[model samples]
Target: MSIRIPPASWAFRGFVLCFVFLSSFPGTILTQEVTLDSIRIFTTHDWFSIKPTVYFQCKGENKTVFPDVKNTNVSYSFKGEESWQPLTKLEGTKCKRCGIYEQDPLTHDTFDEWELCPSDFTAEGTYTHGREKEFNATFLCHGCSQVGPGSNKESGTEKEEERRGMRPAIVVLIVVLVLGVAAAGLVVGYKYWRKKKRQQEQARFLKLFEDGDEMEDELELQNTL
Candidate 1:
């Protein structure tokens, strides 16, 4: 007689094995928390001298206000240990259009706006952005690399910077190439002009010798006469 195993038991074992396999890679399955590491406001959008009520927000997500960062040109840092420390959670490889804004009575004045991505962070899990006369900020998100669109996906700011950096080099290279071509043309022209001049000089010298020979022949004929 052969003992048979129940289908329910097999199903339970399979479920447990799947759960264990998934648990091995928690970074891929769970949303990673993005926390504000530091921030510095260069200018305030508020008209009056009163401190601006600054906050961070992404599209479709509620604002994460910074109660302490009320002054301009002051840098504030965080330990990501507060109750509201993790400002938001990044799902999968998706990037969020986020910005820092000043709360106002009439309108919410924006400090700076940018695309935030997990790929923006460094090996230390930190990302920094500085908008001229607007704001400078640093963000932290541990295990961001594991949940990002891959190592190849760069932040918009970094890509823009790379493009900007390449422009000057490209312009310089083009200028150098143009100058090189112009120099080569000048050299060829000078060589051709020199060769023509040398040929003209040789022809002039030969003509002088020929004229002398003719004069000598005329003198000889007269002497013969």
Candidate 2:
């Protein structure tokens, strides 16, 4: 008994796997009543995400609280920065202090910038690009939508801030991309070259076989003479 795969079927199998890998990545959870924040305010390291989540519940007088999605003016500042820079001035939605999606075009990762979360308890986590290290993050909320807790709206004199240094996040991303492209190029190039070499070798062998038969015939004729 022999096990064999047809050429077309093998190619089809490889295509399916590549599609799945590129479509979605691990550690990414999409769920209801959950907000994932990936903040990129820190220029020190290129690709870092400050992920935090808040869950809310009804309180006081046993009243059921409806989601009063309010203006979450997201601002970013680094440690020891003079003032925070306003990234998104204001935003409204059917969410109370929910972590929303914000993207950075330079490094191409969702930035965590949304502010003020409502919850019975808050949770936050931090990890480097590609699971290098795990660390806990601390975040405080301001100007929360007070359906049952406090404050409805407020504003203050904003400060100015500047980003600094090569984000560790950016460096890691560039390195990974370069390695991936190099690997794919090598694999594809090798397959193409091997196929051409096999064809050329077969042609050379055929020509030598024909020459050998002709030489045998000439030697027989000379002997007969």
Each candidate structure's count of clashing pairs: 0, 13
The residue-by-residue lDDT of candidate 1 on 1-225, one tens digit each, is: 956454355546555654565455423356789999899888877776667688889988888889898877788988998776778887555577888889866556888888787788777788889889888898998877665445455566865676576567557656755675566566667868999999999999999999999999999999999
Off by over 4 Å in 2: 1-115, 118-166
RMSD in order of candidates: 25.5, 19.2
Which prediction has the highest TM-score against the true structure?
1
**Overall local distance difference test of candidate 2:** 0.34
Every candidate's lDDT = 0.76, 0.34
Q: After superposition, how far is residue 40 of candidate 1 from its true place, in Å?
A: 0.4
